[model samples]
Target chain A: MTITVDRKIYSDKCISNAIYWLSEKYIIERKLDGDIETISVNDDNGENFRTEFLRRLNDFKLREIIETETKDIKTILYAKAFGDFEE
Target chain B: MKKYALLPFNFTQIDGKDVLINELGDMIIAEEGTAQKIVNRTLNDEELYKTLVAKFFISEQLLPPLIDIYAARLRMKKGFMDDKTALHIFVLTLRCNQNCTYCQATSREENAAKCSMSIDDMVNAVKLMFKSPSKHLTMEFQGGEPSLEYELIKTGITKAEEINVAEKRKITYVLCTNCRNLSDELLQLCLKYNVQISTSLDGPDFIHNQNRGKADSYQKTIAGIAKARKILGNDAVAALMTTSELSLNYPKEIVDEYIKQGFNGMFLRALNPYGLASENENWQKYNDRFIAFYKTALDYIIELNKHGTFFREEYATIILRKILTPYTTGFVDLQSPAGIVNSVLIYNYDGYVYASDESRMLAEKGNFTFRLGKISDKYEDIVSGKKVRKISEIWSNEVLAGCSNCVVRVYCGADPVRNHSTQGDMYGFRPTSFFCKKIRQ
Candidate 1:
């Protein structure tokens, strides 16, 4: 699951959507965000990826903060959960 | 106005690419749902007005959707050229002694036996370079090691002088080297030829030696900088560099070393995710760590700058230049691929000519390929051929998705080579690429 969250709206939105599309094919966990906030996900895999993604993905430019945000998150999480859009 | 006649679009399948493989087995990754998504969303639009939208996107033509035909005609005007800029890369030599891991130069101890360019070849290449719409030329050199073949250094100046004398064309020269073999002779040549020296220093001794390879790597490079500074004077020996695994932890150390060595600033570069290094597992550190590395280093440099530290960041300078200046060189990486072409060309040791050294580096490692002309052949055939036009289309064409909608498109340049490496296309949606994201930060 990839969670790409960049304020670079148009282009990144497309990438964000693509991650969702991939979700239909695999057990993917994805999310995109505006500003990165430390979230405590109750799911086991959720915390696993969050640690990796946050550790690697911040490049200061909003444009770059999303790609690694996708990959590192994908490696551990379950299901495609996008945005901070809560349950 | 149909360009297909001049240069046809050959939609070959990307080779061996599970998504789209062509005849030669080159890979091209294309998603399944994109075309359908486009079709589904736009199928029910009010009317067939895409031609108007297409014109708007490419030419900034009248806002066809905003009003009726009368208003559009009033708004229509002569279109501005939105093509990629000219880049003139002057390759000084294809000879290098060291065997670094990601050396796309294909240089080594064995390659040293080969001869570099004759003065005549250089003179012709320079003259041919000036034939583009680019008025200003960025004369950058790379090697084997540029210093190995010293005569070409003098010849580059002599040729530039000859052309500059007649055409009065402005040409800026940059020499890329390791500075290991840096000598008084080379420094003198640079001073004489008016070439600014750009060299690499990965980090401090142990790490740099591990990355650059060679026992004397640190001592020799530092010593060479001393000699380079003597001739070029202060700030003449520019530190243009690469980032590797060893360098990730040592950004502060790298900055400190650069200052100690008299480099006024630095470009805390990221390693290219390609070449010999591409296959190696050791070089692949977490991208997050890279971000962290940059954060620490950049903070340090910024602090240095805020306190009136004379240091400036070259990459930051390039970004700032694009942001602050009306005219940007836009080298596609840092350059606007859609602006005027600068008059620099890369002639590899084996006689292949590419638009830039980075292009050759990408091609040699097997992707984003373009050959302008072989030195053995006339420039007419290569430059006029379909491949050159194909590449030029990839560079200047405004039809790409990221580039089209990108507000930063004005400031950010696209590297087809980098894109091809990651996404297997000349125009990968850069705003979406991991490498672009890392660098854009």
Candidate 2:
């Protein structure tokens, strides 16, 4: 199954992460052409891989958003916790 | 309702309540739709809002007033890593007397020649252990049966005792054995050095005997436990159970068996994907059933506690300690940074240093991916080598993809060895991981 996702909607990192996870169960081959990223999956489970792939892709996209929004705060929290500062 | 910024939290539905866990692992059980309201900026309940803010789940003001204090608490939660590795596992030998069906360690026959650790390697491993700056050190002797090599055990401890006269670190010794061969000499050595015995007892006679592949295995083990307890004192002997497919069907019976044996608590350990145990091709099914078995056993134990019996499930206690207490547990499996080389290091019988017990088990099957280095290698090089660097990338649940968004991840752990063995990747796919599923449940 080959699915084309809009690269604008899902960044390369999100797509790659989704592919990395799915690669365990599916032989995934990914290619980027302009704004569209085509993912070809050879699933061993013989199930509908497209829906699950898209769902995981969207999940990674949401995760990317959350990570971006919380990155600075997380850094501040961890630094305050583990870093040595002379205040 | 006021607009408030989120402060790195995750939510999950547990027992019909929305459980929100913050970055520092503080949890709040709120009504259903609470998570949706918080995400959509529509949380109007003034009291709940104030509680969330106070708990550092949401920040009404940029940087909560007690941000430093919150950070300090988080730091304290990870205080296990403050000292270097504390739990040092010495794989004494791979020789065993009994043939167990689900033996994960891949033990050899009783007289398997040249599979034991040499005195030279033991000395070097002890030296490597002292290099770790942990104020308290645990020298855990693991084997097909460490009691089989009583001389090696005595030599290793005697060396540690001699070295500690000046080193003065609080060193604790633990022997992980099958207890079928707890000889008089072994007990005397344990009594001399105060070595704690951790043995296996799957269930009653039928289950234990079948799992051990010896009909009188249960009797021998029971007798061994009694002898060890009599010599080392009752508190010094601890027993753990491995829940195989057969053991799963008898959860209540197993709990009852432990209570019958006069044990106050027991760890309902699931089978790890390693060695002969990994050959069981029905991991998914086993995992599902194991969860059910665990819950049933835990409920029964809780009932016993309610009925004035002091029996507790050790695994649930570890999770509860993380959920209910402000302090972190010393359980290596359930820690962020994966606990591999961070909290424990394995000195295998083959004169190599591996990441953990499972890492060495992987070596038994010809996978040396987690083998840090030889015992003779520099401590700095072994701990900070290329492989360790690669493992570090995915050892933290806070940064992992699926784990970052999990409400239970704060209470759970990151397992790279299990991930690598089961998923073929150090950074495991939690959506497809049985470990993630079981822990989340």
Candidate 3:
């Protein structure tokens, strides 16, 4: 199974995470060429590797969106927790 | 779209409803597409809007007026930090009578040589335990069978009691045993010291016996429970169940068995990857099956509750306590700061301190990544050592990659030991984590 994921849409970290998770069930090999990353799977379990990979990829993208949105608020929250605001 | 700032919240779809969980473990379940609307800033439902605003899910103003209150409540949820290492586990020995197949501790035969904690080690461990400034401490004895070592149990308790006279800390004692060897002397000691008994009962006779690899295991365990309850009162004895592969097919049977044994609650614990149990090659399948089994058992328990049985699934209760209530749970496994050395510590039979029970189990397999220090080491040096300091880095869900943006991070915990054991790293990759999958479900 071969699936090409675009780096512009999904970050390399997200793709790496998806591959790491899927690597448990499928023997996955990745090739990166500029903005495109191709993942090859050797799945003997007859599982739909492409579907699972895409689903997790989308999930990671959603997480990235949430992380990007909440980054500042999280920073402020932690700053208030461990920082000396009075000084 | 109104310019409403986002508070720290995550959203997930469950039962066709969009569930929004905030940083303080507050949650709101809305109709489907609610999360899409929330992310798109198109939410128009007045009641939902009010809920989002009130629960610190969203801020209408530049900053929510309750930012300070939110931070304070968040701090309060982690109040276990103020009470450092309340649960102290004392591994008495690795020797046991019965040979359980799925035993996580990898118990040895009754006469296993040199696996027991020495008196010097126990005395030093007890002294080290008092170094923690926690006003309330619980000394829990664990083993292949702690009942076999009645002397160590007595010695540890007596030492704690002797120290308490001067230190004036409230202390509680717990004995985790298989219940097959709860002798009269052991029961008498338990009675004198007010030691609570925690025994394992997987299910009915067939399942329990099969798991224990003994024909009379269930019968003897039941007899032991009866004896302990009679001697120490029913309230002093508690039972926990570990879900094995075979137990997955009999969820209702397991719940019914607990109820029949007069237990009002059962902790539907998953099989941890350690010891002989880790030798099982089908962890992914086991995890999936266990999740299904947990839901089935929980449903049966709830049905029993509806029928006036008052039975509760303890793991769900801990998660629910975080989700539905404002208070934090004392459950070490499901706490932030990883709960290894923060809320619990283990003094093993080999005179070494471990981060948690699972940490000690890793040591049983010759991996000492989570070994804190020797029992003789100073408490400050052990907890604040170089290794512990490194572990502390990834102990918070607030900072981890996948955990940070998780809608359920508030309800979940950071487990560095589990991460290190399962993923070969302290900072776990949540995408592939079975722990994350089970908890999210």
Best by the DockQ measure: 2
Candidate 3: regions farther than 4 A off: A1-70, A79-87, B1-3
Error of 2 at A56 (Å): 8.5
TM-score of each: 0.65, 0.90, 0.90
Candidate 1 chain B, which ten residues in sequence have the lowest lDDT sum? B3-12
Off by over 4 Å in 1: A1-87, B1-87, B118-120, B282-286, B324-332, B338-344, B366-368, B376-381, B396-398, B429-432, B439-441
Candidate 3: interface RMSD equals 2.6
Task: Please write out the lDDT profile of model 1 over residues B1-441, one tens digit for every residue.
Answer: 211100000111124321321111112233442222222233233222243233221112222132233222211210112221245565655567676765656555625555467677777777666665455666777776887777777777777788788777667777788887776777777787677777888777877787767888878888887788777886677776677776787888888888877678788777666556566464335566777887898889999988887887776776665444334334445544433223245665556677666666666566537556676566666565677667666764234654533334444554565666666777776534766566445
RMSD of 1: 15.2
Interface RMSD, all candidates in order, equals 19.5, 2.9, 2.6
Native-referenced Cα lDDT, model 1: 0.55
CA RMSD, predictions in order: 15.2, 3.5, 3.3
- DockQ for each of the predicted structures, in order? 0.02, 0.33, 0.33
Per-residue lDDT of B240-300 in model 3, one digit per residue for the tens? Answer: 9888888989999988899899998999988999999889998989999998888888888
Worst 10 residues of 3 chain B by lDDT: B1-10
lDDT of 2 by residue, B351-434 (tens): 999999999999999999999999999999999999899899989997898776666888888999999999998888887899
lDDT (CA) per prediction: 0.55, 0.88, 0.87
